[model samples]
Target: MRVDIWSDIVCPWCYIGKARFERALASFEHADEVEVEFHSFQLDPSAPEEPEPLLSFLADRYGMSTDQARETDAGAGANAEGEGLAYTSARKNANTFDAHRLLHLARERGRQREAVDTLFRANFGEGADVFGREALVGLAEKAGLDADEARRVLEEGRYADHVKADVEQARALGATGVPFFVIDERYGVSGAQPADVFTRVLEKAWEERD
Candidate 1:
């Protein structure tokens, strides 16, 4: 079965969904036969390359008080911890164009999953600036990619079209959310569903494949 997941690197629920999917895959009898692909979906395409403080953005966008934003972040942090991810208070947001480009490069090297995991950790756990070429090169190197080559690609802005195309295709397919999973090109699961839901979808896809 082929599974295509559309997610952004900064999305917390995407990380949670990844953990849930991992749990389901561990028990899947046909896990070895499954192929997974990560596709790009930018949550804020117009966001500046170096975004302002997240709290300020939230305040301006949602007209929320600082206290309300803090409370919401605390809740999100707790939810993230439940899925084995650590949440920190450093507020930084940036355009993820380069991050998605690196993902395509990782896919070409057959290390897309590893790249995804590292990217998530670098962004959420370590608070690395995902939009910066230096950060992306570091992440690629950590994922076993050649740091020099990664830097060249980032500097030249290679794979930008591929990332944009994936985002456009996602919108054409009516996906307006991150962490959307399409199994076997037919079964669509939106959001970070429970592991049981993923397992059921996998089983059904496998049976139909036969």
Candidate 2:
């Protein structure tokens, strides 16, 4: 069984949804047989590489005030906390293309899952500036990737096409948002659905797989 997840590191729901899906996978009878991979998806492709206040970005994008955006983040924070994940309000938002490129490198190194987890934690949990290059290299090192290689990849723009291809694939699959899950290319689950939903789908996919 293969589970390909399309999610952005900066997306709160993607962080929460990953936890939920893992919870389901943890308890699945065929857990050891499941091969899970994370694919890159950018919620804001045109976002600046330099960091900006996430709340302000949200406020401008949704035509809401900063206070309203904070309230919305609070709700998302609460949901993340429900899943035993940390969520801080002072998060930054920016272009994640380089991060996605690094993910492809991590995948080749067999540390893709760890890299994804580390990036999510750095952005949403520790409130680290994941948008910055040095910060990203630190996070990659924390995920057990070689720091020098990670830095080189970022500098040289390695795996850039892989990142773009992943985004294009997401579009071809009709995914208009992050946290999209495609199970065996058979079932598509969107957003932060509950763990039971993931469990049921996992089981169904397992049963129906040829």
Candidate 3:
């Protein structure tokens, strides 16, 4: 079984969905046969590389007051914790192009899953700035990737097309949000659905294959 997940680094639901999916995989009898691939999807394609503070960005975009933003943040933080991700004050959204590049490198090294997990932890758990080149290189290094090679790729604007292509493919596949999962490239499951939902889908796919 193959699962291709389209998600963003800063997406709270993606993190939660990841955890849920992991749990589902663990519970599945044929876990060892499952292959998971993480694909890139930017929440704000037009967002600047260095945007304003997340609160301000949300406030302006949604026309919400600062207080409302803060309240929402608190609620999101609690939800993130429930999903096993720690949320801190250091959280901010940065341009994820470089982060996506690092992910591409991880795929080359056959460590894409680890890279994705590290990226999510850095952005949501530790509140690291994922959009910065240095931060992205650092995360790649932590995930056992070659830091120098990662930097070179980012500096040279490599894999930008791959990221864009992935986004376009997701759109063509009718994915409108992050945490979108395509099972066996035929079944689509959106959002951070419950583990039971994922388990049921996986079982159905496996049964159909057999």
Candidate 4:
């Protein structure tokens, strides 16, 4: 079985949802037979390249006060801690197009999953500036991708088409949000559902596959 996950690195729910799904996948009976792929989806395509405080962005975008935005982020952070993952709200928000491009390069090198995890950690855990080119190369290196090649990919704008294609495909699949999971191309699960829900879906997909 193959699972294609569409998500953005900056999305807190995607970070939390990934942890939940992995908990299910790890305990799955046929875990070794499953193939998982990560697809890119930019939550804010028109977000500024220059970084800004996430709390301010959330406040301005949603008509909430900065304090209210922090409260909302705190709620999400609490959820992440429940999943045993670190969540920091003191991060900057910026365009993730280059980060997604770097991930495609990681995919070519058989390190996409690792890269995805690393990016999430950089964004939400350590509160690193993941949107910059230098930061991405460093994160890619941490994910076991070749540092020089990763730099070259980012510098030359490689895998841009692949990133754009992922977004287009997600649209074709009727995905309007991040963390959308398609299991065996037959089951679509939206949102950060509970672990039991994912386990049941995986089992059903496994049983029903030809």
Candidate 5:
């Protein structure tokens, strides 16, 4: 079974969804046979190249007060805690285009999942500057990838097309949100669902394999 997940790095729910999906996979009888791929999807492609206060960006984007946005962040943080993710509020917003390109680079080295988890933790847990080249190279190294290769990939603007293709594929698949899970490209699960839901989907996909 293959599961392709479309999600953004800075997305709160996507982190929670990843934990839940991991839990499901852990208990799956066929876990060893399952293949999971994480795809690129930018929640804000037009977001500023410079980092900005997360609270301010949320407030402006949703037309809500800063307090409301903070409250929302707190809510997401609490949910993340339930899954041991320890998510923190966004202190800075970053353009994830380069991050997505780095993801493709990591995928090429067969460390895509590790890169995904590392990037999520760095951005959401540690509030690292994911948009910066230095930070990305560090994250890539942490994921067991070559730091120099990662730097070259970012420098040469490599894998940018792969990121674009993933985004386009998501749009063509009628997805309008992050954390969208496509099971064998046959079933779609949206949002951060419970582990049971993913487990059920896994079973169903296993039964209907072609």
Candidate 6:
């Protein structure tokens, strides 16, 4: 089975959804037969190139106080802890175009999953900027990709079209939000659903495969 997941690195729910999906896959009987791919979806494509505090962005966008935004983020962090993920919610929201481009490069190197995990960790678990070129290079290396190659990919803007195409496809598929999952190109699972939901869907898709 092939599972293509469209998610943004800055998306909190997407990170949580990944953990839930992993748990479901771990319990799947045919886990070894499954291939997971991550695609690009920007929650805020026009996010500033210069860094800004995540709390300020949240408060300004949602018309909430900074404390209220922090409270909301803390609640999400607690949920991430349930999945054994260390989420800190103290990072800045960045333009993820280059990060998405790196993921495409990682895919060619057969390290897409690793790249996805690293990006999520950088933006969520640790207070790292996924948009910074140096930071992206470090994450690429951490994902088993060549650091120099990763730098070139970002510096030269490689795989940019692939990132755009992924976002376009997500829109065409009626995905209005991040963390959309497509299984076997036939089954579409949306949002950060429960692990059991993913498990049952995985089984159903595997069985329906012809």
TM-score of each: 0.94, 0.98, 0.95, 0.98, 0.97, 0.97
lDDT scores of the candidates, listed in order = 0.86, 0.93, 0.87, 0.94, 0.91, 0.92
Tell me model 5's lDDT, rounded to 2 decimals.
Answer: 0.91
lDDT of 6 by residue, 84-120 (tens): 9888867898688888999999999999988998888
Instruction: Using TM-score as the measure, name the better of candidate 2 and candidate 6.
Output: 2
Angstrom error of the Cα, residue 96, model 3: value is 1.2
Residue pairs clashing in model 5 are none
Candidate with better lDDT, 1 vs 4:
4
Query: RMSD of model 1, in Å?
Result: 1.4
The residue pairs found clashing in candidate 6 are none
Best by lDDT: 4
Tell how far residue 56 is off in model 5, in angstroms.
1.5
As for candidate 3, its clashing pairs are none
Return the lDDT, model 5, position 133: 91
TM-score of 1: 0.94
- TM-score of structure candidate 6: 0.97
Off by over 4 Å in 1: none
Tell me which of candidates 4 and 6 scores higher on lDDT: 4
In model 3, what is the error at residue 128, expressed in angstroms? 1.3
- Per-residue lDDT for 154 in model 4? 87
Q: What TM-score, to 2 decimals, does candidate 3 have?
A: 0.95
For candidate 3, lDDT tens digit of each residue in 1-210? 899999998788898899988999999998999999999999987777984677777788899997888787887687778876777645786667778877988998998988998988888788777888888888899999998999999899988888999999999999999899999888999999989999999999999995
| RMSD to native, candidate 2 | 0.8
